[model samples]
Target: MSATPPPTSSPELKRVVTGALVGTALEWYDFFIYGTAAALVFNRLFFTDSDPAAGTIAAFATFGVGFVVRPFGGVLFGHLGDKIGRRSTLIITTLIMGVSTGLIGLLPTHPAIGVWAPILLTLLRVCQGLGAGAEFGGAATLLAEHAPPGRRGYYASFAQTGVQIGLVLGTSAFLLVQLLPEEDFLAWGWRLPFLVSFALIGVALYVRLRVAESPVFREMERTREIVRLPIKDALARHPRNFLVGVGAHINDTAIVYTLSTFSVAYATAELGMSNHGALFGVILFALTVIVLQPVYGNLSDRVGRRPLNLFSVVFVALFVYPYFLMVDTGVPWLVWLAMMIMGAFGFAPQVAVQPVFYAELFGARVRYTGFAASRELGAALAGFSPLIGAALAARLDGAPWLVAAFLIGTAVISFVAFYASRETKDIDIADIADIDIAGIDPVRKPVAEE
Candidate 1:
């Protein structure tokens, strides 16, 4: 019942992939700097209550706020992505993210604004969550649809690569500002990273404005196959994929925040490590992930996505305890090594293969809604990971066993999800009938089309 996509030329595919990469990289850079600020600056600047531990948890709670509202963003933007087109939806998302980030750089702190400070920060974070909700999903979908059937994994991985680049840029911006005196860093330098978004917004706009629409979506439009309520249709028609995508996302979402945001706060608070050192570990970890994304992605293209997904969760489950042990050693080199090892095998492979894997779970009609909502829901559920890590560590008097156990539990969830889901690397994404969704009904069409 699906229309065939127009044949995509190689040059167009490359152009789209490049745009997705540059645009996502810039957007995610905004997301990551906020994480860094939560770890280092927000607690002191915005949530200036007593109790250092409580303040840290409060800061991370605001960080989690961005994740909690993501499903709403998913629904709103996913509708636009499925209804209008992927290209325009991505451009809107980038605009939302970039503008919100730039505003954060100019916000007044608690000392100047009192209670209004945290309130405004929370409000701005909601804006970020909304924009971010669909950024990755739309980028991945666009890349997957443009990609040749055999190379979807390899190409879609670029979306994730852009995310790592953003992490590098976000962390690197903080690192540069760290060269300032501590007083200067706390006063004005912290704002510099967020302010860079002003510049990045332009670059993102330039790239995204040039990207082509998904050919699969074009075919859907040409044949009037657009869905009216895509989220409802996705849930009713492809419940299994909806659930699999949700469960499959928990491990990476929780672990990445735990490793990047929580671990930074943990090291500075408990291990007596300098903020510079802990942030350096994240940079190293991100660099490792950036390097291995394409390697794992290309491998998934050859061997299939399931194996890498399974291996990643299992490795992460087993490695969490050892990971904590290495970090607790308080040795800078060992900490960097711990981050890299986990980032390499534990996080990168699954994440690299994830976009294409999720992309193939539904037909193009529901792909944006299903992927963004399900994945972001998992993220919402785990969004409090850094807060949880802080609370658990405080409860245990700085011991990390409880947090380790929590991560292992998340890993188990994803392992079961990967086991239940079918391999999708070889599937034709445009063929609604051939996708691996359960109880997929092909005759259902949108009540209205754009």
Candidate 2:
């Protein structure tokens, strides 16, 4: 076995977890602001030429464009992360996302810039996508590598929990902005949230700079186990594991987008509810996620990740139809209840453990690349979910049945992927090289015995 560094200090572990939490929170806050804007304002602001339905489709398409560029970002930064170090890659991604988001707040509307408005918007969205592509994987990998053996799931989950906090901040920001008059809101009020994101960047940078580098990566460098091309090594050496990570990741992105982004448009535009009401529902659900994700992650350390993940996917598949039914009622209480059930209960478990689950799939040499590349590739399927949901609703005479079915299909794909993969909760990070990429071993036993 390679000589792993001594365990991270207690205070240092706290600092590292705090940095991961703060940095990801700020980055996702920027990302989520765009999603909120795409649903609430972008169609009218950027795609004015099309009818309302067509405009929403176009706007959400731009949202998906970010996802399109994410895999590239993952490959680019994942390589740097694997080669150089996690700390530096994180700082670079933070600056890229922060700058792109701040610039978006300053962009002129279609009426002012004509065609250039959307062209610039798409370009900036690409930058945002690239930045986001590396954030989760990097954060998760860093935290998992730092965490103590039995508590990796709990520590790694803080990254995603921070993301949920970002969702709450972003949704709440929009809710506050939604209070303005309709004319002013459509004109200038919507830019406030994006503009405020600049301050968050400063705070995130401060926290991130304070944290030490991942001990696992340092040990790799000390032991000279670092690979030349992490992406190539990950693919060539671990194809099955990479594919498994991709399949396991699809539903996490798809399900979240369906519940949060598309449902915002579905509730407001199609159901005739107010944006305030929808944003409120989103805020409530996000708050629930912040509280539950860690609990679920901690639970996974005891019960195992596969059962929780499988249960969550199956639960979402079953609940999505009724979830939409509640939304269509135009009653705020029912919608809130439905979102709480879906987000806090059904969705939280998968998301809670996903970071650790993917990070655990690879050995130290290619962990960053394997986790980032595969997860973002899966994100490509999810990136267009809101756009697809919009189209499905339009095609079905404004009903959400087809959209719900599509969500169920994605869930099943993820379930199958998780079912086929082996559990890694008990695997030692230092000894991971003893296991093959396909999760097979002649001597070492599987973590979870059936």
Candidate 3:
């Protein structure tokens, strides 16, 4: 029999992409706002009375708290996503993120609540982590499952674009608060951005509600083939793919967290840049990311995933040192240049194509579980890179090179991990699940119905 032709796009494709974008944007807005708060307000508001350095460390530790909870979120949500449907899982995650972030805006400070202030803050952060962990994997898998065969990378890249949109909005909000009087900004202005998330979340929920379920998922449901134990199946059948996905994702997460979140503190504390100056750098880089995501994603469609990902890893290794040097020079324009290059060109390739690449590592039955688990595992490592970098910087007496060395080591590990995996560019989506763990050809078998 002739092979089944790859599916073509319909009006449904547009709807799926729109849903992915809106939901992803809302989730990331929630995530990025916490990072902004950690940099500017959390140190003083939650960790008061500690030494300045200790306060900063404590605030960042809370930031990492969210990352710590992600893997459990991935497992919980991934199971539901694989068994129930992607559309429902995404909507649930969006609500969790939106509600948690809005409540953070309304929370009372340390003076009002004493030690309970940081405790409440950390608890909310864990909720944010739970939502964020599930959101990206579902969105990416939904988009990829709906996309036409040759354009999965291009379509799925919109999910990453949503992340850039969130960064733009979140960082821009923080920058706006900087314009207020210091007393006003510290007292009330910071709360404004968190409160505004309510409106954005409402809009995202409306848009997402209108989109239909993914066609591939629908077909699986029709065939009664949805795996009941997705995580177990993924672990048993695709261990190598899972490990490789973790490795490929680590460097991308590290670079982004370092540049956007950690850099704010690093620039101010070590490089002697003002808070406004560091925020401006973040804004510039966020804009660059917005512009570059689609370009690199489309490039992956043309050239391939392995080459582009490898190039990104190598570029980061080479660029981290120079990037820090430029930032340390305290030249505002040079800092802008450095951030733009790092965000737009250095990190774009892997970040843009990863949704499609990582999702494709497993078959449709376990795509959500495999992708979510591996991606969060990788991010777990990255989640700690900043803390490590901070400690290394302290030990080396504010030496940026030491941090650069650590980032380079992460890049090296990622490169080796990805190098060991099979390229999935031309593989048929339905056939991906049955592929061997050792990167060999699939042992062709009859397709099973749910």
Candidate 4:
């Protein structure tokens, strides 16, 4: 009998990449706008009349709520992705995120409904969290499964590009709102950005709906090789890889959140910048990150994942303290430069390469579940780091060093965990399913009778 040939890459790969990038951009735009709102306006609107410090803390705590619920969304969506298909899961997540974001724009403020305002806002944020938890995993899997051999990193990095674009749009929109009169901005202008999400979500749905299912997933379905319980199988068969994947993502999550979301609160509350100035710095940083992610991703293709990822971590450890020192000087341009460099060059490489690295860690059978669970689990730690940093900032009298030290510690943990992982740069996607152990051993153990 003749052997069956491996699936070949076609124009479909381009379609999948385009769909993933556009859909993810819209989803993240919705998610990121919420973060920007929480950092700036949500507190005053929802927590009205509280102490400023206490309100900021409460606002960020609600931001962290989304991160807390994300893991559950990952599990739920991951199961659906592995069992049914990536296309449908992507469509569902985008709708959920869009609807929740639109609702937040129309929600009643504390003045109108008192305590129910924040409570309803928290409920909507949870819905956003659930949608986001699954969105990245599905997009990454869709791109990775369709990419040609030896170029998965290049193609998968496109999803990260969507993330950068989303951040850019989200922050830029908020900056635009900052230009409004103070009273108008607080009363109604802030809600305009959230309302804008509906138009972007429509674009995402159109793009995603046209893309076909991943070839690898279709093959698995045709062969009746889909795992009956993907999450359980992933846990049992790939515990070490899952742990490594989670650890590898720690720095990316922690540092990105710290530099972007937490920095807004830190600057306005602690460093005495106006809300507009703080958000403007974040907008500048987001633009740099958007430009640099694809470059770093292509660099990873040449240098391999471990070396580039390690380089990023080491740079983050060395630069975070100095960056904070510059920010503490209270010079607007210096703070902007520091944030731009930290986000663009210091943080981009790790974030750019991680989707490929994490996707490569699992086989086709459970790629969605493994990637979703591991990445979301790591992100949950990051979601809370801002709250932890806020608490520490209160005790330290807004000393930036404390937050820097905490970020560096997390980076070190990521570096060590990544160092211990097996390299998958040259492994074929089809063959990944067979790599059940970390290394080869010649000795075989006898099966014991149960």
Report how far residue 83 has shifted in candidate 1, in Å. 0.1
Give me candidate 3's TM-score against the actual structure: 0.95
RMSD of 1: 2.8
Candidate 4: lDDT over CA atoms? 0.83
Candidate 4, 1-450: lDDT as tens digits: 011225545777778888988988889989888888878888789988788777877888898999988888998999999999999999999999999998999999999999999999999999999999999999988888788877878889889889878887888888899899989999999999899888778899999988988778888787777888888888877778888877887888888778777888888877898877877788788778778767877777777888888888999999998899888877889889998889876788888888788888887788898899888988887787777778778888877678888898899989987897777777666556623454531012113300
Kindly give the stretch of ten consecutive residues in candidate 4 with the minimal lDDT sum.
Answer: 441-450
RMSD (CA, Å), each prediction: 2.8, 2.8, 2.2, 3.4
Report the Cα lDDT for candidate 1: 0.90
Model 4: which residue pairs collide? none
Which of candidates 1 and 3 reaches a greater TM-score? 1
Which residue pairs collide, candidate 1?
none
Which pairs of residues have clashing backbones in candidate 2? Answer: none
Q: In every candidate, how many clashes are there?
A: 0, 0, 2, 0
Candidate 2 residue spans exceeding 4 A from truth? 434-450
Work out the TM-score per prediction.
Answer: 0.96, 0.96, 0.95, 0.94
Model 1, 1-450: lDDT tens per residue? 355576679888878989989999999999989999999999988988747788889999999999999999998999999999999999999989999999999999999999999999999999999999999999999999999878899999999999999999998899899999989999999999999898888999898888889999898888887889999888877788788889999999988899889999999899999989999999999999999999999999999999999999999999999999999999999999999999999999999999998888777888999889999998899889999989899889988899999999999999999998887676677864423343444323343321
